[model samples]
Target: MASVTYILFVSSVVQAQEQANIEKLGVERVNPADVKAAEDIADQILTKMAEGSYYEFKEGEAIPEIVQLFTKDTQKQAYQQIKAQVGEYLSSLEFQEAYSLSQGGMEATIFRFKGDFSKSEPEVRVVLDRDDKLAGLRVLPWTDQL
Candidate 1:
């Protein structure tokens, strides 16, 4: 029992540390064009979600890259949940910031955006891998602290 408890605690700490690292965003330098491109990708995605019937993915107005398979499925479910919570999707307000993080020798750029919907506003994050592929996407309620 004692060993199991210790292992669980250690695993939790490791997960916390990983999240902390992402929050820190050590890299200071970022390309302006890259940020713009990332923002565009994020915008395209949200726009599609807003327009697509039943929250399905739209065909046109997408970045020319592959979104992660898991992300696509997960995003569909998550988007549905968000739609239920926030009502219909409207328009995204603005792009916030983009930052890069490296893990296991691979680097990914994460971009933030402020989103607008019928019922609520949310903050969105889009992650693009080194090859400019969509790696991850998340939407959360807006918080002042970010």
Candidate 2:
């Protein structure tokens, strides 16, 4: 009986720690307007990439400053790599959360999404600058196996 009680206490503490870690990441609910804008931009970009129209984003779709960070060639290569590894797009994208961070006096919002690919489900993060331009983007494999 005492062992059972101890186990329950330990489980609760572990759950609280996990919640705290998530909060430390700055994840929080964002305004509905911001969520809509970010989702629209992210979805548009992802859709285009899935359709093999990588070069089209070189225009107004993405900010030139941020695009230079990855370079056009590198961006195309990354897209191809994802396509090869993840197969084709499966279209199960759902907004997960958003976080705000400041760097060099500029504020950026990170929008996260749990998206389905042909091979696996990955978390997609799209960072937008104050002007609503893409500042950074990344796709990482996500799993509950942890």
Candidate 3:
């Protein structure tokens, strides 16, 4: 009975997120003449993120499948659950710095955030498609020791 309620809640959230993604991406045609425009679109999206307003653009909803790469699916409820755990960890600490890297043809941005959690910094990577849509996300609480 309790499990059924939990499942229903999660399913509702996923369906809501999927709808939000469709609206956020919208329906637009891209072409050579729109190259700069496309870049602008990406820049606008990233800039908004940098400003610390991170959430689904469609309002009152979570971003959809920010971890699709690891799951190989368009929607990943498991990924969303893992992400919430990581987000909680970050939110619990007093963060000091945020560093970002986008290199070597990887359509992803890796952000390192230092916080009171430990001497080890937590990191997040967001991969985006050519249309500037989110493809996936990875969160690491600490750097792997070699």
Q: Of the candidates shown, which would achieve the greatest TM-score relative to the real structure?
A: 2
Off by over 4 Å in 3: 1-87, 90-121, 144-146
lDDT of 3 by residue, 64-89 (tens): 44322222221234334433443322
lDDT of each: 0.54, 0.57, 0.30
Q: List pairs with backbone clashes in candidate 1.
A: none
Order the candidate numbers by lDDT, best to worst: 2, 1, 3
What global local distance difference test value does model 1 have? 0.54
Residue-by-residue lDDT tens digits, candidate 1, 31-135? 666667667766666666566522233353223333223245555565576677665657655767666556555566667667687776676666666766555
- What range of 10 consecutive residues in model 2 has the weakest lDDT sum? 1-10
Q: Please write out the lDDT profile of model 2 over residues 89-144, one tens digit for every residue.
A: 56557877776665445565667777687876676666666777666666666543
The local distance difference test score of model 3 is 0.30
lDDT of 3 at 48: 38
Off by over 4 Å in 1: 1-28, 53-76, 144-146
